[model samples]
Target: MNNTISSVCLPKTYTYDVEGQRVLVALTGNPFNYDPQTLYSLAARRNKKRGFLFVSKVLGKHVPVNPYVPLLAGINLGAHFIEKIHGVHQVDVQAVVEAVKKNEQTKEVYARVISQPRFVLPRETLFIGFAETATGLGHAVFSLFDNAHYLHTTRDKIPMLQPALDFNEVHSHAVNHLCYPENPELLKTSKTVVLIDDEITTGNTALNIIRAIHEQYAIKDYVVLSLLDWRTKDNRGNFRKMEELLCLKIRTLSLLEGEIDVSGSSYHEQSPQNLTTDTENRESFQVIVEEQLLNLQEVVSVFSVDVNGQESASPYLKVTGRFGLSSREDQDTLPLAREIGENLKPHRAGGKTLCLGTGEFMYFPMLISAFMGEGISYHATTRSPIYPFPKPGYGIQNAFTFPCPDDEGISYYVYNIPLNYYDELYVFLEREVSLERLQPMLRVFSQLGIPRLSLVIASPVSRKTEKR
Candidate 1:
C-alpha cells in the first residue's frame, strides 16, 4: 500500500474540565502538516499527578488500530533519525514512504536498509526502549541502527535476574523499571545511548534514566525518539539545563512536534476505579478452561550462564531483552514473525480476531498480530492500571483484568475491548506458561462470550553462552 503521512488528521484545540481545574489542550506545531487526530487525541488521565493524556491514535494500547500504523510510524521515525545522523536532507516523507513500500514488496529491501546503516552509532552505543508502549517502537528503531545493542525496561522481574540499571517513570502507575542485560558488558561498553518512548511529555523520565545510567557508566551522546514531542516550552528548556548538568548532548526526534493546552475545572470527576459487579444484581457468567485445546509446549532446551566460574543449565530460551537482545536475534525477528503468522492463519478462522501479547512481551507479538491478516486488532496486556469511564470521549471504556503469568500477584489489563467484539482471541507469550497462570484470563474471556481462545507460546531462542 502506498500510504503517505499526509492522510493523517492534523491537530486542533482540545479543552476539558477536571477536578475544578479548567484544562485546555491545543496543537501548536505541524512540522509535517499531518493530521493530529490521526496521530493522537486528548484524554483526561485518571492519575492526579497528570491531568491530561495525549492518547496515541496509532498505538494499539488504548485503541485498536491497524497493526501497520504503529509499525510504519516507528520505521518512519527511524528513517528521520537516520537522515539527521547522516546529514542527508533528501530523505523526506516521500523517501520514507517509498522505502516502506519497498519493504512491503520484499523483505530484501528491509534487510538491506536495516543492515546498511545510513548513519552509524558509536560502536558502544546502546538502544533502550521504554516499557509497554515503546517496547515495539524501540525494537523497530533498534533494527535500523548498525551494530547497536537493544534492551527494554520492565516492571516484571525474572527469577535470579539482576538489573544493570533501574529508573523511575514518575507519571506512570508503575514507576520503577529494571534493566537486566545478560552480559554486563552490554552496559559497561556503552558510550552513547538512544532512549525510545511513545511520546515525551516532560522529558523528565528520559533525564532521570540518563542520570541513573551515567552514574554507572559514562555516556556522551543521548537521543530521545518518540512518535510525538509534546514537551512544553519550559520542558524543552529543561533539556538544555539537563545537558549542561549531565555534560552530554541531548537531542529529540519525532513525527510530530506540538503543544497541548489543558483547561478544565477543579470539580472532581469520579471515573470507575476498577471492574465492579454488584453481587446481587450481577449476572452469573460461567467460565470454562479447556487446557487440552491450548497449544502449550515444553521445550527442554539447555541454556547455560557462567558467572564467577559457576556454570549452570537453565531450562529457558533467553533470546532477547530484559537480558538484552543481540544483533543476531534482532535479525531473526522478521523471519520468525513471518513464520508465526503462517502458523497462526489456520487458527484464525473467526470473525474479528484480537491478538494479545503478555505484559512487557509486546514487540514480537505485535508483529505477529499485524501479519495475521485483516480484521485483526492488536494490543498487549499492561501493568499500568488506568481508570475506565463509560462515557464518550474517554480513552478507556472497558477493561479486562487478569493475573500476570510472570508474577501472579500483580494485575494486568487489556483495555477498550468489549465482550463480544472479537469472536476469536489469540494470547501470545514469550515465556513458558502454566495452567495456573493462564486460568484467570481464560475465565475472563469465557465470561465475555469469546467463542474461541488459543494460547500461542513461542519462547525466545537461548543465545546465552559461558563467557570465559
Candidate 2:
C-alpha cells in the first residue's frame, strides 16, 4: 500500500477559498484504505477563529445520510479500538468499508453485524462524547462496549444540576461544555475514560478536559478517539506534555490522520439572514404532532429548575446520556426506537422521507429513522454556521436559519435541504414545543415544499398544549 503523504491516488492537496480566506488540507495518513472524499468534504465555517470545517458525509449532521452509516462508522471505530488496545480483532474493517462505500445495503449490513453480542471490555470504561456535533457519534461508539458508561457534554444550563466538569472549545461557536452526570461515581470508578468526538484538530479540547477530570477524578488511562485526527507535530506534542504533567496514560486514535494548514487574512462575514417566507403552497402542507409514545410509562422524565429556583417538570429523556446512561439502558433504547418507528411508519406519506433531529438530540432520531423503513434519510439542526456554496464537492449546498424551537434565544440551522427533495419530513425534538415556537421551523419546511410534516416529541405534557 502506498503510504506517501502527497500520493497522486488521492488528491495531494485541496484548497478552499471562502470569501477571501484560504484554507488548504493535505492528506498525511489513510491507513484504513478508505477514500478521504467518501468520509468528508471541506466547507468554510462562519466563525473567525476556525475558518474551515470538515463536514462529515456519514456523521448525519451537516449532510443527510443513511442512519445506519454513522452507526457502522462507530462500530468500525470501536472494532479498531478493541484491536489496538486489547489485541482482539472483533469486526472486519473491510466489510464496514464496503457497506459504507455506496451507502446501499447498509441497513442489512448493520443489522446483521450489530446483532452479535457486544465486546465485553476487561475494565469499566467511561465514554464522554463532545457536545453538539459528536453527541450521536459518541453514543454510537459507546454502544459497542458491553461494560461502559456514556455521557455527552451539553451547552444547556439545567438548573439545580451542578456540572461535574466544564471545559472550553476555544474555536467553537459555543465555547462552554458542561458535564452533568447524575451519578458522579461514574467518573471516579471507571479505570479507563474515552473521550469521543467527530474530529480532533489541535487536541487542546481533549487535553483541557483531561486536566479538569484529573483534578477531580484522576483516572489513570484516557483515550481520545475521533473520525478524523488533524493534529500537527507540535500540536501532538502537547498531549505528551499533558501526560507527563498529569502522570497518566494518553492514547489517540482515528479513522483518518492528517495535517492541515490555514493561510490568508481572516474576513468578517455577516451572519446569513433568515430568508424563509410564507409561500403560496404553505397551506398545502399538513403538520402533525405525535405524542402517544411519550405518554407511555416506559418514557423517562427528570425535573429542571429555573434561574428563579422554581422547579419545572422536564421532558428530556434520561436515555440521551446527557445525565449519564448505562450499557443496559443504552441497549433498552433500541426497543423504544422500534416502538416509535412503528408508530410513525404509517404516517409516512411517500417513499421519500427525512427525519430531522434538533441539535444534540441526534442519535435517537437516527435510530428511529432506521426502523421507519425504506427511503429514509437522517440529519440534524446545528448551531455551527457554515458558508453554503451550491457547487459540486462542497458539503453544504444550501442552508436554512431558524430560532431553536425549544429555545428561541439561540439560532439553529439546517443545511442541504433542496426544494421538494423529500415528500415528507419527521422532526424529532427532545422537549415538547409549542406551535408558536415552531412556526419559524415550520415555515422553512413549507418553503421547501415538503407536503407532510410530523413533529415527533419524545416527551410531552400530560395535557395537550399545542394547537394548529
Summarize candidate 1's per-residue lDDT along 1-468 as a digit string, tens digits. Answer: 011122224445545543334555455555555555567654445566765566676666667665665566676777777676656542344644443433343233333444453445546668899987788778777766656788888765443666788889999877888887877898888777889999988888998998988888877788898888878999999989988987889888887776755545322255434442212333435532222121223322433332233333333334335567766556776666767786777666576988877777677777777667767777778766555556665566666677776556667777777765677778777655556756777767776656777777665334233221
Per-residue alpha-carbon lDDT of model 2 for 346-411, expressed as tens digits? 877899999999999999898889999899999999998777778777777887888887667678
Highest-scoring model, TM-score: 2
Ten-residue stretch with the least lDDT total in model 2: 274-283
Poorly placed runs, candidate 2 (over 4 Å): 1-6, 9-12, 266-293, 296-312, 463-468
lDDT of each: 0.65, 0.80
Question: For every model shown, what is its TM-score relative to the native structure?
Answer: 0.81, 0.91
The local lDDT score (0 to 100) that residue 432 gets in candidate 2 is 70
